[model samples]
Target chain A: MASPQTKRQKSSKDVPYELIYWPGLPGRGEHIRLALEEAGAEYSDTAFSGDSAVQTVLGYISDTNLGDALNPPVLAPPILKHGELIINQTPNILLYLGQRLGLVGDKADEDAVFKVNELTLSALDGLSNEPHDCHHPIATGSYYEDQMDEAKKKSSDYIKNRLPKFLGYFERVLKGEASKSEWLYGSQLTYADLVLFQCVDGVKHAFPKAVARMGKSGDYENVFKLYRAVQERPNIKAYLASERRQKYGMGIYRHYPELDEE
Target chain B: MASPQTKRQKSSKDVPYELIYWPGLPGRGEHIRLALEEAGAEYSDTAFSGDSAVQTVLGYISDTNLGDALNPPVLAPPILKHGELIINQTPNILLYLGQRLGLVGDKADEDAVFKVNELTLSALDGLSNEPHDCHHPIATGSYYEDQMDEAKKKSSDYIKNRLPKFLGYFERVLKGEASKSEWLYGSQLTYADLVLFQCVDGVKHAFPKAVARMGKSGDYENVFKLYRAVQERPNIKAYLASERRQKYGMGIYRHYPELDEE
Candidate 1:
């Protein structure tokens, strides 16, 4: 095994990681995109557009390079570069990037990093599952309209049960923070804060009613403040305003008021 | 703010943490159990039984100290303690515990640790989604019989695409190790190895035909061997034998021959 002295990312060559994701919905890719953008690193993004996405996803999943072997997810996008690395789970991907980016903060800061990351991932998981539910609602195989009744039920379960659980968890993290500053992490912006922004964006896109009704609760105010602050970061602001920050559609967040209970 | 001293395990006059999950079906609880067990720490599994589980699950989703005031999920075995912390999403839980157990190995080993753990999390995510598909086949809300065709499609996609993608990635990781060592982290064991054992075990129980067909891909030989070794470890062996290692049922894995496209 090589010694640690030489392995650290002390030079430019260390920034060779490539991020792959659908050119459409910003979705989970934002977490990764944000980390890379904020870090000002030289990672490449192999973004796919429209009809080409499916092949791109499949090709990456099936690649046999020891560096790129196995699949990350046969889904929208998976990120890779060097160190023989690939990851599909967005929060998992972000956690990997957070370590390299300053997004994770420091060792003394990791507990919040871990906790906020966990909550962010849980929210994203809920959102992703619901996204599929948006299309299929009943069976992943059948059309969403075909299973409208079942879709309504599943979507109801999601809007009523899942969203609050996630938002409430974020609220608690804020409440429990050593400082009362708004962000989920201590006071400053962390990667978790950005994901929370995405989560809010997704929820607002998918379940606006549920989110608005529940917005009366005190927990969301600070989370919203953090969300707005994250939105204002120069790099983050640019990404969100760019075409790369595409609106949610057939992806992880789809708008259908019928799916969102009052 | 408290000054940096040591990130000591949560030991207090009050209970350190409370882990709530169904008494049966290891689901996502196994990883939490592993963390607690490895730490040799004190904890109370809040709802490992029939009634408490339902109450705990409902309570967590609805309440503030538990849910973050967002919509809750129908199936979330959440953990609470140490400053009223509540988190779900299995990879997040395991990531939190890796450091706690000293199982994460080394800081110099961060890249490897992140890669392997991400792979492990990706594997578990695939298992969870596919396991859900085994019964649903097509979608989430409909009865098992309602969407068998869709279930088949989803499962087929999983077996052909996801299974190869995940397993192949790990196979490459083991192959890519500089010393030509078998472990994903080269010589050492990681939380990823343990989760891989769970994935293999779950696949065998839930989709025997698919795994059987995949039939011992060469790279995972070390993983399989490690699984056996983990089983041999006195604590793990005892845990498996104990009531704590809940068998697959309706939650994480369900053996449905129909979904297992042999």
Candidate 2:
């Protein structure tokens, strides 16, 4: 059996990870990028591949495409390619990376890793997924302009109800005994913290006024603290300041003045 | 390391799994229950405990609850308590059970387990989560009656566009080389098949007209074939016939005639 150190070394050295996602905005791909960047893992993304990047992603998800004997067909991008294997789904990608990058925990402590994953899924659901639905409440294929009124109503309810519920849950999680440190899981930092960091950052971008009010009101002190802690991490800090980190635009989190808190 | 058979034996016999979820409707709890029943694992649920069951679930999820030193507080129900550990999130619970119940794959086949999880997450997102959103597009806290118009719009969009996209993806997956058998992964059945079965069944209950139309159109032959295979599994067949299986009502999948495909 490979030692954790040996496993980490092999994963980082042997495979040159390829991240396949749309180029412009971060979208769901940013979560994968954050984990890669935080670990300082050797990787490449289609962010700079120009027109071919879009085609490459589309090719994998094309209706007629039946994945080869090993890999399965992809539904959407943010796919990770390591050696001959290819996989997608944001949380799934994280779960795969969490072990390889030494971001989860010791292999012996399986519970900790699963706990981290559970926290990540919850964070993604309430913060990332629900926030995305606010603008596209009627249909993903429809334009935000067409669903403007619905977006307004949904965003309002999100700020009033869902936002507090999720943020409060995380705040409580951070205060739990297992979280002796600022990280969501154990004393050691895990991929879940990176996910929550991105989630909080995205929601702040989407609903600045509402998030700011909650922050000022001291409702989520621990949650904001963890966000700030992740932001200040050396690799993540450098990544955020680099040209590689894509800005939020028409992706999951969008800031329309009408959708912001009143 | 223990053999797969030994590990399965230990998990099933040593830890009497206690499933904690609201009684009556299947809801998200059904997904977890289906997995347990399929494995024929020794488990108990709050279904027969009546009023106390509600209190027990609420106690774990109460806002003031700072879970004991080992476990973190639960965000919501459908929690599983095995030994000293208490975990929530439907997929997380399944991931945990998948390992112990030997439903994912062989321990050495790590990729298969992760792949099963990826398929489960995708199935849950498109089939399970989106269908629920069709009725409560604006806010989960709001009543279906209040959001009836938006519900109609979201449900229509779900039926027309999203449903086909997801079902088609699964059909293509079933045809992929990796899925030599009826299952989503390798030749063996994994927890993903169980999840997909539940998702398809829930959607059928939610939108009978649309699902029936697609069934007759023969769009998802492989997908439905696998669903039928899962339903025919002896344990599942028996569980369905027993009173242990809750009826679907005002849960994740609801039958609102107006929300049906015209």
Candidate 3:
């Protein structure tokens, strides 16, 4: 989509959006990339720059880097730079992009916009944030090995309680009246579905045996159904097969055999 | 403040806003309550409903409670009910209330709105959510005593690293050009300032010694300055003194002598 507002532009270009995040690993940036990719919107990914982009991402978050008059300092990536606006925070970026890319409903439909944002926030919290905590229960800066015992406890508790709580919640959302279609929101697919898809995919990757057991139990039928539906979307399918969709590694969602169900 | 939109109204009201959250403690719900109180808008707080309100909050999130077609199922508390809308997620509720209550900015100023929301999210992340995780590092459902060792390590790391990082970040924002006024956003007080104030207050309550040392060291000059400013605001001052402003207890921000600085 062409840049709509003049005030937002520092300069015009073939692509207006630039995503500055850590190199490799889907991490949180995957949520932003999914929204952009599903919309077929061309944008720059700093991850494509390889090693050099690591410092670029760090610079934005560095204590010394005081953001300009308009934008405040970025705490962490994925930071989206569209012209003069340097916005961070995963859900905030998705909210901004959702409005522009039509991932949310029309501009006038404030209900859909906020509702999509609400669901997006919930998925990011319950699925993305909680899963990350399982591997790094004690501290973010510390190594996973240092907190292995706590990680095991966290991972087990997550599988038994938090995981099912979130999955079942989404399952309920899908079966609810608002989701008249196969999607989580109204008839159309929004960024929320894409987010739910990525988080579920990461969870399954992290704990394959447990997720498979839950799948077989027929508890989250619609949640898995939505996940598969998002995967098969024309744009998303192509993007997932492409190099643009990064792999899961030692990132937010990591696989540890001991932490998983045997 | 009157309810502005006709579509939002289920019926006319003396108090248009109803806050449904866990009773007794000033948890996440305090963020929404601060905005309503600052705006001098009338709101119905379920906390005042005594022991009975706990079940009402639980009812909203109950597995069997399938929300109406317009509103989806509420996964957690701090749910805001305004006429036909029942919005959850602290930041999302703040976003909704900010616009209506004029705690953000003028309706046309989308820039301020999103910027404010972005900052609010960051504060909620670094300050509120992270601290909650400190005590419950392993699992939210688990007792603090069960994870006391992990909590100590997390709290120590938080005090040494995360606390300074967040405090310093906000301090820079206050020193930045955008904050010509004392508030985090533009000159006037926004919901962000209220959020920052509440989070900082909670942090202080949780870690008195660490925060006192940081204060005496002359770091976070502007952050604490803004915090004091918010506290002194007429409406805020009244709210803080009143019984409506709940105490910090075993909620998100807790005080444990063992968790504090030695």
Candidate 4:
């Protein structure tokens, strides 16, 4: 079996895409990083730089320093700057990169692009955002420790209900005719598959027991297979082993023993 | 100023787009509805029909009945079925409709489409999903009354932080070169502007006192002006007056009075 990395065409542009995200934890930036790594695209992530670089990420979001001209000042980091275009929002940045990097399908099939986008957005909604809320149920401004009691309840509901639903949905998508073997979309690797891989990886870190149980239950067979397939890809495998891959911490998918279920 | 609706090119497809959502309230569906109405496109909403129609909407979501063949089973309502494509996410549906109905910019400028999509997704994140969470702080499965104490805390943080951050972001977007006048992107009307209008409308219903204060503070002048401009559009104005327009209730944006700040 040939690695999917061998098939990806290098980005025609020589411009190295600049990704500005918080240092340390993977957070939402992992999704974009996965795509760039898988495609062997030229990019420089600011997260690896020192604390001063993190300040550069914060500068874009701060109201006082937003300068006089920039429209739609970003509220958070994981901001992508490619030449003149500066954009935030993980899924939006992915959509733009998916198109530019040819991570989306053939240019002529416009509908397929939308379908891939739909899948990516849905995965983000359930896997990333909801999981983040599990640790901070009451407020984003407050710490997880401040809302641990509420987090426990929210995590219970999520582990029982949403986790299965989302995982099952992706499993079915894999089983569909559109995804012949391992890809989430029609017959080829798209950015959405990378997103799903990161989401599952994060969920596993967050709720080891629950995810382990789901794995043993033999329910989402295709989903697990898809995760392994992405993991085995040459570029991705190398990236995972390298120091560039950030570890899971107090980010979106935190491992709080109290929040997990058997 | 002439209403932007007059310039909208109707969807070429003869098929009346079917919108499936919860019966009573205009939640995420309103974003899609606003686009269809502004373009004068043909659409049939399942919410207006009988109980049997609601059952049909429920069937797509029910796991046991989703059948074996369907991939990526939708977890919730507000599903759009047009021809063969069945997509759920609010921003995804709007993206599809925006392209088909010519609500997005020139089809040739692909980057513009993504930019418009970025804006729409950001608005949904800040306005729709966040507001919904305010009333359901602990869990979506639970009711507002069950989480009243938590809801109060969440709503206070939202009013003080997230609401202004989002509204101010849009106001800045409007003040930019991209939006010379009424629209959020470019000089013409796009689906994103309609989405912004609905979001502002929803936040107002969910937190009247806070929104009123924001209005009086003259902070989000461009945002309020964009809302009014969308409201005054001939087709949108008529739709707002018509029976077809669903009122806000216990949906994404709800008025509990207790959740509002003076």
DockQ of each: 0.25, 0.62, 0.63, 0.32
Candidate 3: stretches off by over 4 Å? A1-15, A106-108, B1-15, B106-108
Candidate 2 global lDDT: 0.89
lDDT of 2 by residue, A17-60 (tens): 89999989988999999999999999999977987988988888
Number of clashing residue pairs, candidate 2? 0
**Superior candidate under TM-score, 1 versus 2:** 2
DockQ of 2: 0.62
Worst 10 residues of 3 chain B by lDDT: B6-15
Clashing pairs in 3: none
Candidate chain B TM-scores, in order: 0.81, 0.94, 0.94, 0.91
lDDT of 1: 0.63
Question: Residue A108 in model 2: shift from native, Å?
Answer: 4.1
Interface RMSD, all candidates in order, equals: 6.7, 2.1, 1.4, 4.8
Off by over 4 Å in 4: A1-14, A64-72, A106-108, B1-14, B64-72, B106-109
TM-score of chain B of 2: 0.94
Higher-ranked by lDDT: 3 or 4: 3
lDDT of 3: 0.87
Q: Where does candidate 4 clash, by residue pair?
A: none
Worst 10 residues of 1 chain A by lDDT: A67-76
Identify the candidate with maximal lDDT.
Answer: 2
lDDT (Cα, tens digit) per residue for candidate 2, span B107-189? 66557767888889999999999999999999899899999999999999999999999999999999999787888888888
What local lDDT score does residue A235 receive in model 3, on the 0 to 100 scale? Answer: 98
